[model samples]
Every structure is written in C-alpha cells, then in structure tokens.
Target: MSRFAPNRYRGKLIIVEGIDGSGKSTQLSLLSQWLRSQRLAVSFSEWNSSDMVKGTTRRGKKKQMFTPTTFSLIHATDFADRHERYILPMLKAGAVVCADRYAYTAFARDVARGVSRAWVRNLYSMAIKPNLAFYFRVPLDVALDRILGGRAALKYYEAGMDLDLSQNIVESFRIFQSRILEEYEAMSGEMGFHVIDATQSIETQQQQMRQIVMDRIGAALENDILRSPLEIDRAG
Candidate 1:
C-alpha cells in the first residue's frame, strides 16, 4: 500500500462542478464563508479566473469561435496552470482547497460537444485529482435558462446552435450528465463524491455544504486557533 507522507500535509481538495448556471459560484462562496467562520486555513480558486477562456466563453453573444475542441483545450490549459501554481501547493500545505470547477466540467461539456472521451481525458492528464468532487445536478434547459438569463445574443462559444444541433447538444449533455452521475454515485461509496440535492433552495445547499466542510476540517480549525504567533514562529 502507498502510505501517506508525514511531512507532506494532504489537505482535502473539494470541487463543485456542473453545467453552466448550475449555481456553482453561489455554493462555492457559501462554503468558503462557512469554512472561514470555523477558522480553517482554506484557499479558494476558480478555473476561468478572469482568464482568456472565460472571456472567450462570455463573448459568446458577440461571436462564436470556440468549437468543442477549442473549449476543451482552453479548460485543459486553465486547470493545468491552476493545479501547478495554486492547487498542489495548498494541498501540500494541509490547507483545504475549494475549486469552483474542475476536470469534470471538461469531461461533461466536451462529451456534450461531441469530443471523444479519450481525447478529452488525455488533455487533462496533468491535473491533480481532487479528493472530493461535488456535482450539482440540473437539467440542461434549467441550466441554459439560468445562464442566458444574464444576457442575450450568443458570444464566441456560446452560440445557441440550430435546432438539430441544439437538440444534439442537449442530448449530449443528458448522456454526459448521466454518465457523470453514475460515476459520482459509485464514488460515493469510496468517499470521493458527495451528491447534494441541487434542486433545493440555495440556502439549504449552502448549509449542507458548510456542514460537510466543517466535518472535514474540524481538527485543522482547532489547530490553527491553538497555534499562536509565537507557536507558529517556533514551528517555522
């Protein structure tokens, strides 16, 4: 068996993933706030952090240049950069890291966009897998409406496809969602995934997420509180 590294602090890496407008941002904020209240050494990061891909995706209303392949590649680069610079370091520091989106989005959306599953997975080979990933399940239409509610006209990649293509996309999302749902269900048994009732009100979801984070970081929060400036200095 591969034993845990004692000098390396293995903080729980938690990720929340789902289709656009699945309320991932809201849930991430709530969970981070709850962790702070409990005094846990937590760090927050996002995939599209004001980066090119996010800007490109947001520009969907102006012009659509991103195909499924382009979208997948952008996310792949985004995560690889994020993992190397932010995620891995914090995880090694024993600080809980919460990510708003992760590789699951690439897997789900790329498959929905007709990209081969193997190709998409290969692009993300550098990403450090999260210990726990929570997927918020919602219908495509619900997600679409929520996303489109913010604006009008398709941007670079957000072009609403033609009827036949649109149907295909929705169907793809359904197929992709179903596969991910099954994977998450199986992972639940192994403590890698925790499925939340996303259909519930946002408040309820926040509460549940807070409880989960608290459960994971209980000891860490206490340790931080006990470690005064002098104690930390001595340890350093």
Candidate 2:
C-alpha cells in the first residue's frame, strides 16, 4: 500500500491515455475547459512535463544519448517529480486533477522498450491510483497516419529510433506503437482503464468521456461523502 493512501482525499485524479495520435491530449484540454465552465477546480498535468527532468530527457533524446534502461529511469524520475509537485498537492487540496498521461505511460512504454514489467510496476507502486483512467484504443495504422499527416517529421524518440527496430522510421513507429498497445490492453483489465474507441468522432468521444467523468465523480463522492471536491451535482 502507498504511504499516501492512508489519508482521505477529496480530489479526483483522472488520466487519459493512448498512442501519440490518439487525441487524448486534445480531449483532456477540452475536458479541463468544460470542467472549469461548470466552476470546478481543475489541475492539469502531462507526462514528462516535470521541470526537474524535462531538460535532461529532452537533451538525451535529441542526441540519441540514452539507452532503454536510462530512458526508463529518467521517465520514472520525471513522474516522481510530478507526483510530488503537482498531483499530491492538488489532490490533497480537493481539486479535480486531470492528467494527460500518468504512470501507465511508463508501464507500457518502458516495458515495450524491453524493461521488466514487474520492475516498472514496483517503481510506481508508491503512487496513488487515479479515480478514473481512460485508455483510447485506435488502430496502429490510423494513429500513425494521423501523426504523419499533421507533423513535418517524427521526433526520434517518438519514432522509436533509439530501439533500432527498423530502418524505416514509419515502420518503426508502427511496430513500436503496436507493442505499446498490447501492453496497454494487458494492463487495462488489471488497472481499470475505461476503454474508449478512438475511431469515434471527436465530439462523440468527448461526450462519452465527460459522461464517464461525471459518473466517476458521483461514484467517488458516494463512496465517501467526505471526499467530495469541486462538486458537480447532476441537478446543477
């Protein structure tokens, strides 16, 4: 059990996840706006956004300087910083917390990079679970096509270039993303991810996600009346 789990929490931690082009970031941004429109206190966090490790991680990937093990450890450090600086503070304050990607990114991406799944899980065991976790599932080809269409070029890390899996970056992204998807699917059952079909229209997906968020807020509050924060009563 996590040391932080002993204390009662009033805030809800919601996480959205998927491959690079799965539209989770976009949705999370919109969700934050919608939550605020309802006058809820919302705090948003993104993967690798920690100031403590971002510069080092960026420089490493830019120079192709990190091995898989190094990359995994750096990400774990980044997440640990996030947990301390943003997640823990906001949740304890009873704010509704939204994360673009959480520790599961490490679980899937790190394991996909050949790191041990058990090791990665243990690395994140100290963290508290999210009140709601969303996994957007899109086909590999669809995700890559969406990515390639808008971007001028894929970043080396994004393409899994460090892994040396393929001479072609496009093919490499396909294979790498497929592995991540497999890991996420395997984890969804155990981790309680509410799977969202990414093939759906943006409006439809957003609507569904908001509904789930509303339902979860209700469930969490019902579980403990003292846990209500940034309340969104249905009648309101």
lDDT of each: 0.64, 0.83
What RMSD does model 1 have? Answer: 6.3
Candidate 1 on 1-236: residue-level lDDT in tens?
A: 11212223456677897666678888988877776665667788887663645666666424655566776777787777777778778877767788987776666566656788678777876666665577787665676667667756443233324212435554543445455454444434443557777777999988887776568655555663222132355655
| Model 2, span 97-216: residue lDDT tens | 899998889889999999998888788877878888899999888888888998898778887888899989888888899999899888888888899999999999999988988776
Quantify how close model 2 is to the true structure by its C-alpha RMSD in Å.
4.7
Model 2 lDDT-worst window of ten: 220-229
Report the Cα lDDT for candidate 1.
0.64
Q: Number of the top candidate by TM-score? A: 2
User: What pairs collide in candidate 1?
Assistant: 59-155, 59-156, 60-154, 60-155, 60-156, 61-153, 61-154, 61-155, 63-156, 64-156
Candidate 1, position 4, lDDT: 15
Q: Candidate 1 at 233: error in angstroms?
A: 20
TM-score of each: 0.70, 0.89
